[model samples]
Target: MDEQQCWEIIEAARDDAGQAWDHLDERLEHTLTRHLVKLSPPEVARFAEFFRALQHRVNREDLFMAAFLIHHGCDDDGFGDFRAGLVGLGRDWYTRALQDPDVLAEHPAVRARADISALMLAGFRYAPERALEELTGEEYDGYYDSGEPVRLDDPPPQAAPVPRRLEKLAALFPRQQAYLRELYPQLTE
Candidate 1:
């Protein structure tokens, strides 16, 4: 499926959950899987491709730094989960975040410091694969040919320069830094 179609599926899942951030991991996975199961296997596979591609789009150091500050120090796995959770926020929020990671400071979940990891929306990261498995009675291996590397555990080689210190990250994302301070009043620049 194309990017727009991919977003529609996620948006539908968000709507299915009444746009509430609570228990979104289970809710989004169920809704997204329900939508994917109705499609042909190839469509499901294509959706997986697009999903990974979109995740890849946000695999940058700036976003990683934003996640680190928001989540209180992000590792590789945390960054991956954070990216998936960002996608789960829907297209408009995702695009705005792409333009300015600082905008995340205004997000309700971020303001509440909710865990934006596998427990949030990353369970649906593999929803298309799960749907394919259910439909074809076999595990999905369609992601191998998406032309993107499968090393979600590894930072991308072309990732932008990550600030080496919290002070630098704070300087780069002043708005987010302010929000972070609000979350952790003891934190200092």
Candidate 2:
């Protein structure tokens, strides 16, 4: 499948899940897995490849800062899930986020400080791989080689004091840093 088709599948699953974030993980997994089951193994693999590529696109320091600000804090794995969450937002938002992660400040979930576990579930779900396993009765081996790089932009800076970190983050993403300051007063205090 092509990139647009891959996004269509994700968008379909998102639409199928509707407005509620409850059980979004399970609903999305079910919808994506069901859709993948209809495709041939190669097509399923292709879809996974596209997903990986898209994930790579958002694997940047500035976007990671956005995730960290939105979620309060994000570690290595949390960043992975954050990228998946960004993808789950669908193509246009994803594209805009790729260009400027501060746009994420507009999202309701980020604003409400709601349970965002479902948004982060895509990285953990591994739906395409799971579908491949179910289809072939074998584990999915389609993954980037060990040599493949994950970051598409600069790496995050070394750890430092919260205020100092905020300065750097504010420099990189002023809007997101401002959002974080407003949402979590204790952090700024």
Candidate 3:
């Protein structure tokens, strides 16, 4: 690990207070962007918006946010933080719709989702929902079409579900409970 990562892990793994200060400078996400590839101009702006929305739900401390980001984005592809990009785009949609509920109220399909959580594990795969063949309705028409295949994987891929993703991450790292208790007293209860 690099100097910054080690220091960050040490500090970030501390109590919530430490994490807040450490991350306050955006250091919490420095390593986050380090591994991130880049996305299109639009995708980058979109994900920034999504990450902003998730900032509110960042309770339960780092694990929740980490898990969410890792689960959603954290892909080492050229466009880093793939999930963040999509969710950001989705958040923009949500905010726009909130200001004008009737815009999508007439649309049956777009009515039933929040946070772009539903967008993961799909062909859109957070590339650009509006650009994707499946999800976009009126939005797809006359957009700059980038027919790039976002993956180097086999033609058909099956990604894990959200719950399974959480379990999987916990299992892989398997941080000790006692350590967690030391870091977060509330975890013991």
In candidate 1, what are the lDDT values of residues 1-189, reduced to their tens digit? Answer: 677788888899878966666778888888899998999887887778778877878877667767867765667887888888888888888777776666777777766656544223567777877888888888655442545443333233343343323554465457766765565454332
User: Which prediction has the highest TM-score against the true structure?
Assistant: 1
- Sorting all predicted structures by TM-score, with the top scorer first, yields 1, 2, 3
* Candidate 2 structure quality by residue, lDDT tens digits, 25-127: 7777777888888888777777777778787677776676677776656788888887877888788788767666666766666555566564576533488
> Lowest-scoring 10 consecutive residues by lDDT in candidate 2?
152-161
Indicate the TM-score of model 1: 0.74
| TM-score for all models, in order of appearance | 0.74, 0.73, 0.22
The lDDT, on a scale of 0 to 1, for candidate 1 is 0.70
The 10-residue segment of model 1 with minimum total lDDT is 150-159
lDDT comparison, 1 vs 3, better candidate? 1
lDDT of each: 0.70, 0.68, 0.30
Model 2 misplaced regions, further than 4 Å: 123-125, 141-189
Clashing pairs in 3: 37-80, 38-78, 50-88, 73-83
Backbone Cα, N, C clashes tallied per candidate? 0, 0, 4
